[model samples]
Target: MLAKVLEEPERGEFFARREDEAHSLVNLLQAILDYASLSPSLKRRFTSALIRLSSKSGRFPDCMVLEEVTRLGEDPVAAGSFGEVWKGSFYSEVIAMKVLKVYERSNVKELLKRFSAEIIIWRQLSHPNLIPFYGVYYLNASKTRICLISPWMQNGNVVQYLRREPDIERSYLMLDIARGLEYLHSGKPGIVHGDLKGENILITSSRRACLTDFGLASARDSELIMSSSTPNARVTGTLRWQAPELLNYEAENTRSTFASDVYSFGCVGYEIYSGEIPFHEVKSDYYVMQSVTRGARPPRPPLSLCQTRGLDDTLWAILQSCWLKDAAARPTAEYLVSRLRAMPRNAEEKTTPAAHGWDRLTRSRLSHSLVDHPLSCSAKVVQEWKQLSLFEDWEA
Candidate 1:
């Protein structure tokens, strides 16, 4: 089947099939099964072949990421106090390598515990959208370096994706991400992402996104989340997507509960619709938190626009529910996915003014990006997905 796909120049990259890919995969046998009926053994062979293909992505002492890794350096992407990230590869698969540098305050033992925990936790997580961990290595010395390997996305990150084209039907793509979240929330201990924002979400060659950088997923052991000693530490998350509860930094953020992630997802939803950072119009995280805490809801995606386009309100409601200030309020990611899938696909309006209901949010750059598209509206979902800043445009 893959050979057949290779026959077509467009589908030649058979190994790049992403479970959440925006486009159809023609090459793999399982993909063929998805396209047409096939025998079970054929599927087995396909899986075996893919494993071999995937294995080749990372292996060797002098791999690209390994060679490029340094004791102390600038972040290949960008830097925050959390850690310094680098772009690297394993086998041949591109990976975003992260190395947290040590400091005077760095507790070698505690730091190691947390860093090791990050890798160990990811080792057990496997989902289409939850980025997988290939391996980890440390340099010997007081330098105290910890490197984690994750699948690299040709595109940069989710925030950049929205900046270029915000009107795409990314809600479906979010469904895939939700599955990963559901898996995490359904685990034995039920992992808490601690941090969930656009920068941590990455896009694959196929334009499907995977959640990465789990350097802070530890769950809280707090009896009263609002009773933390250090209120300032709670502000560690990205300000743009700050959840209301994250404002107190210490006291209010006492518990890194599942609800906190939901709150973050709500802010992400806002980013998706507005094509701008959450609270970009705001002065500070504290101010944004005030609005969210007081139910200062970000304007909803225009119902007229949504209705005109036949967008799913149920799904939109699910996205909005994540914004609830009470950390105990949001639905589980699994439940949200279920509701989204059950939604009718009848609301696909083909023609309409781009500036109907979401006039304030949808403007020149965003609407213009979609106006000239030559593919199906669904095609635009991915058509523009690749065009987004995170990944190189694939139209060529």
Candidate 2:
């Protein structure tokens, strides 16, 4: 009977619909496996069935495979370490398509399985502050390449939006991010936005800040990012927002934690208020890593600029707490949500003129052209680049 069960195809759809029942069944099966005094052969067969069932039980309830999508242009609108984002139309509605870059020699099946695990967590999430996952579809028949679909935010990321509309209420933007983090951290295992930065925080048409990339990459993907030989675009861009613990070469606990996410949150706060990347003064990525590990933090923006941006002393203090060297000393996401919510709106920011000497800060930093910035590319050029296997050396 167990052999027959193993031979049968997994009923993913059935388990997807009855998730509670699936979980209950899993629990019952686990209990039985633990206590039942079965013969060796029967026990082995029962374990195999349980393993197969367990894998199917986590399927997304409403998994979608979008069949039709029209690319808006040839060049990608944005690029990331793992993928390039193309502006596309899906069923007459504007959407963003994140085309994942998978090398020809890569283990496609293993990568897809890992990505599917992340999607299982991503699909069930629903919040105003979170970017909505439209669905995913293969870009190729072999399923070597895939595209993730999400709504296109015309307003762009929070940093770009704030740069254009400097007078926008920054505290409210911070509140949106804090709320998003709170919601993510409230989950059972708590989803960590492993790569949180200005670029990952999109501004919706409604002008609300929504988090985009969260737990999309597995540990193996992180190894590539940390590799010295990897593209500078992937490495240095994220290093600025990374926590000290994550950057410490000597530290054994290098994995991203809730504390690390909080640290990135503070960096994001700096970017939103200052209109500059964290540690912009440091010209080199190597130095930035060294500085962070040595307990250095981004310098406080000028008091006048802070006032204009509504970043008062209290808020600055909160940001500082997030950067504390001791990970345990950092504030929780829940605490941050409450603290940001209770912050009084600064009336001075509304009436104050845009702060001076801000452009100097931009000029001072070395150009980070490789960083994921909102840049347009010609469709033809991007198409030609896509065909080059050398350009696809790594996978996300």
Tell me the tens digit of each residue's lDDT in model 1 across 156-246. Answer: 6876765554565676556556766777777643566767877788765555667777766642222211121222334565655656666
- lDDT of all predictions: 0.52, 0.64
Query: Runs in model 2 with CA error above 4 Å?
Result: 1-62, 215-237, 346-396
Q: Which 10-residue window of candidate 1 scores lowest in summed lDDT? A: 56-65
My TM-score estimates for the predictions, one after another, are 0.60, 0.68
TM-score of candidate 2 relative to the true fold: 0.68
Best candidate, lDDT: 2
Query: How far out, in Å, is residue 208 in model 1?
Result: 1.7
The digit string of per-residue lDDT tens for model 2 on 190-283 reads 5566778999999877677888875332222221112111112123338899988778666553566678889999999999888899988779
